[model samples]
Target: MKNKHLFLFILLFVGLVFILSTTYTVLAEKDRRYYENTGEVVWEIDTKEKVVALTFDDGPHPKHTGEILDLLAKYNAKATFFVVGENIEKAPDILLRQYNEGHDIANHTYTHPIKTTIPKLEAELKKTNDLIYSITGHYPELFRPVEGQYTDEMIESVVKQGYKVVMWSWHLDTEDWKDPGVHRIVKTVLKGTEPGNVILFHDGGSNRSQTVKALEKILPELQKQGYKFVTITELLYMNNENEK
Candidate 1:
C-alpha cells in the first residue's frame, strides 16, 4: 500500500510537470505568432531592391520646404516627408506643396512629443493624423515616432490605428537643426546611403540651411548612383507584391 501510494504521488508530479511544460509551449507559440504577424516596428522597409526612400522628418518649414521640393523636382524623385501636425497647421501651404509635388506626406505626431507616456503618445499621434487629413484631404499610411521613441504598447496602438511605424535604416544626421553647412549634410548622406536605405533628414523646426544646401548636392549625386527614390507607400506596396 505504501509503494502504491508513492507511485501515485510520482505520477501526479510528472503529470503536473507535463501540463506546465505544455502550457508554456502553447503560450510561447502564440506570442511568437503575434510578433511575426504584427511586430513590424520599422521606420523603413527592408528590401534588397535597388530602391532608396528619402524620408524627411519634422518638415514643411517655410523656406527650406520649398527649396527641398524644388530639388526633388529637379531630380524627378519622390521622397517621403513625416510632417508635424502643428507645423502643418502653421504652414498649410508647404504641406499642400508637398502633396501637390507628389511627395508622400506621413505623420510625425501632432506636438512631436518624446512618447514617454501612453496617453500623451496617443494624443500626439491622433492629433497629427487629424491635422494631416484636414489639410491634405487624405489619410497618411505611415507614421514616425518623435525621436524614434516608442514602447511596445505604443507600437501596438499605432498599428491598431492602421499606420505603419517608420524608423530609418540609415542615419545621415543632417543635424539641420543646428544649421550645419550644406557640405556637411551632403557628405553625411552621400557616405551613408545604400540601396534600399531610408535616409533621415529634416526640413522644419529651425534654420534648415544645411538641409537645403545638402539637397542641392545630395540629389544629383544620388541620381548619378542610379538610385531610384520612391515614396514610403510605393516602397511598402512593392515589397508586399514581391513577397507573393
Candidate 2:
C-alpha cells in the first residue's frame, strides 16, 4: 500500500510539471506570433531587405521641418513624419507639403501627452485625426505615442480607431531629442545600421539643429551603401524586391 501511494504521487508530480511547461510555451509562442505580424502595433519589421525606414517625430516645425523636407527631396528619399496636431495648426503648410511630396503624415497626438488615461488618450487621438483629416483628405493610419508610452488598454483603444501603434528600433535611436552632438547622432546610425531598421529623429519638441546636421551625413552615407530610405508603411509591407 505504501509503495502504491508513492508511485501515484510521483506520477501526479510529473503530470503537473508537464502541464505547467506546456502552458508557458504556448503563452510565449502567442506573444512571439503577435509581435511578428503587424496586427495592431509595430516596433520594427523583421526582414533583411536593405530598406531602412526614416521616421521623424514631433514635427511640422516651421524651420526644421522645411530643412528636413529639402534634404529628403535632394536625396530622392522618402520618410514618415509623426506630426502633432497643435504643431500642424501652426505649420499647416509644412504639413501640406509633406502630403504633396508623398511622405507619410502620421499622428503623434494633439498635445503630445504621456502616460495619460484611456479617455484622454482617445480624445487626443480623435482631435489629431480630425485635424489631420481637415488638412489632408486621408486619415492617418499610423499613430505613435509620445515616447512610446502606452498601456494595453490604450493600444486597444487605438486599434479600434483603426490606427497602428508605431515604435522605433531600439538599436537605431540616437537620442537626438537631447540635441546630442551631431557626430554622436551620425555615429549611432553608422553603428546600428541594419536592414529593416526604423531610424528615429525629431523635427520639433526642441532644438533639432543637430538632427538637421546629422542628416547631411546620414542620408548620403546610407544611400551610398545601397540602402533605400522608405517610410514606415513601406517598410512594413516590403517583400517583393528584397536585396538578399
Candidate 3:
C-alpha cells in the first residue's frame, strides 16, 4: 500500500510541474516582442551565405524613401520595405517607385496599432493587404507587426491572412526610430551584422535623416565585405535551399 501511495504522489507531482510550466509559458509569450522561435514566423534566416536582408519599416516616406532607394541603387543592393497603409495612401508614388525598382514591398498594418484584439488585428492586416494589392496588383507575402509586438493569437491571425510574419534580428536593430546619431546607427549595423541577418531601420513615424545618412556608409561598407543585400524573400529562399 505504501509503494502504491508513493507512485500516486509521483504522478501528482509530475502533473503539477507540467501545469506550472504551461502557465509560465503562456505568461511569458503573451504580448511580447523579440526574436522568432520554433514556429512559422521567421526572424533571421539560417544560412552561411554572405547575404543580409535590409528591411525598412513604417515607410513610403516621400523624401527619405526616395533617398534610401537612391543609396540602394548606388550599391546595387535590394531591400524590403514594410509600408504602413495610411502612409501608402499618402505616398503612393513613392511606393510605386519601390515596386518599380524591384524591391520587396511588404505590409506593415493599416494603423500601426501595437495593442489590439485579434479581430481588430485581422482587420488591420487585411486592410493593408488590400491597399497593397490595389496599388501593386500583387499581394505581399510578408508582414511585420507594429513595434514587433504580438501574442500567439496575433500571430495566428497574421498567418491566417497568408503572410509570413517577419521580425528583425535581436542584435541588428539599429533603433534609428529614436534618431540615434548617424555614427551610432552606422556602427551598430556594421558591427552587429552576420550572415542571414535581418537588420531593421525606419523611414517613417519619425525623423529619418539619420537613417538615410547611416545607409550612405553602411551600404558601401557592407558591400566591401562581400555581403549581398537582399529582400526578405530572397533571404528565405536561401534558407530553404540550405535545408535541402
Candidate 4:
C-alpha cells in the first residue's frame, strides 16, 4: 500500500509540472505575438477637436525655415520643427528664431542616419539634445526619428533620454522634398487635411520653395474651414485633457 501511494504521488507531481510548463510556454508565445502585431509605432491621435498639428522635419533652413516661420506667424498658427543637429549647428540663428517664435523644436537625430545601432542612436540623440539645449536653454521634450524609422531598440533608447516620440497623421507629404511644384504641394495638403490630423512637410534638404507656396494656400484654407493649427505638444495635451 505504501509503494502504491508513492507511485501515485510521483505521477501527480509530474503531471502538475507538465501543466505549469505548458501554460507558461503558451502565455509567452501569446505575449510575443501581441508585441509583434501591436508594436509598429504611434501614427496619430484620435480626438474630436477641430485642431491639427503641423510638423516640419529636417529643417531650420536659411530660407525655407524663415519662410515657414513667417507664414505661421501670418496665420497665427503654431508648429513643431524636428530639426537635425547638424543643420542646427550650421544655422543656430534659425533654431533660435524657431524657439523665439514659440514654435516647438524637437530632435531628429544628429546626422539623420537611416539605420543605426543602439550606441549610435544614443549618440545621435544625446548630441542633438545637447545642441538644442545650448541654443534654446532647454533639452527637447520630443523626438522624431530619421524618416520615421523606428525599432524596438531605438524606441527604448529614445525613451531612456526622456523624449516623447512623435509621428504624424494625414502625412500631406506634398512630395515637396521631391520639388514637385507648388500647385501639387498645395493640392495635396488641402485635400488630405482633416480635423485632428498632423501634416508633414520639409523645410530643408533641398529647395523648398514649393513647400512655402503650398503653406500660403493650405494655412488660409484650413483656417477658413475653422481648423486650428497647434503644435504636437498642444495636440497631445488637448487629448489628455479630453481623456480625463
Which candidate's lDDT is highest? 3
Badly placed stretches (over 4 Å) of model 2 are 1-33, 239-244
The residue-by-residue lDDT of candidate 2 on 70-125, one tens digit each, is 99999999999999999999999999999999999899988988667778878988
CA lDDT for candidate 2 = 0.84
Question: Per lDDT, what order, best first?
Answer: 3, 2, 4, 1
Error of 2 at 240 (Å): 9.5
- Tell me the tens digit of each residue's lDDT in model 1 across 1-244: 9999999999999999986643422322334335435645554555777688888988778788888888898889999999988888889999988998888989888877753577777788778877878878989888887766555676678888887877776365456667767777788788887766778888888877777777888888888888899998888787678667
- Model 3 misplacement above 4 A: 1-39
Error of 1 at 69 (Å): 0.7
Model 3, residue 225: distance off in Å is 0.5
Q: What local distance difference test score does each model get?
A: 0.77, 0.84, 0.85, 0.80
| Pairs of residues at least 3 apart in sequence or in different chains that clash in candidate 1 | 42-167, 43-166, 43-167
Per-candidate TM equals 0.80, 0.83, 0.85, 0.82
Q: How many backbone clashes does candidate 3 have?
A: 0
The deviation in Å at residue 173 for candidate 2 is 1.0
State the lDDT of candidate 3 residue by residue for 132-236, as single tens digits. Answer: 888888899998877776567767777777888888887888989988799999999999999999999998886799999999999999999999999998888
Ten consecutive residues with minimal summed lDDT in candidate 4? 24-33
Which prediction has the highest TM-score against the true structure? 3
Better candidate by TM-score, 2 or 3: 3
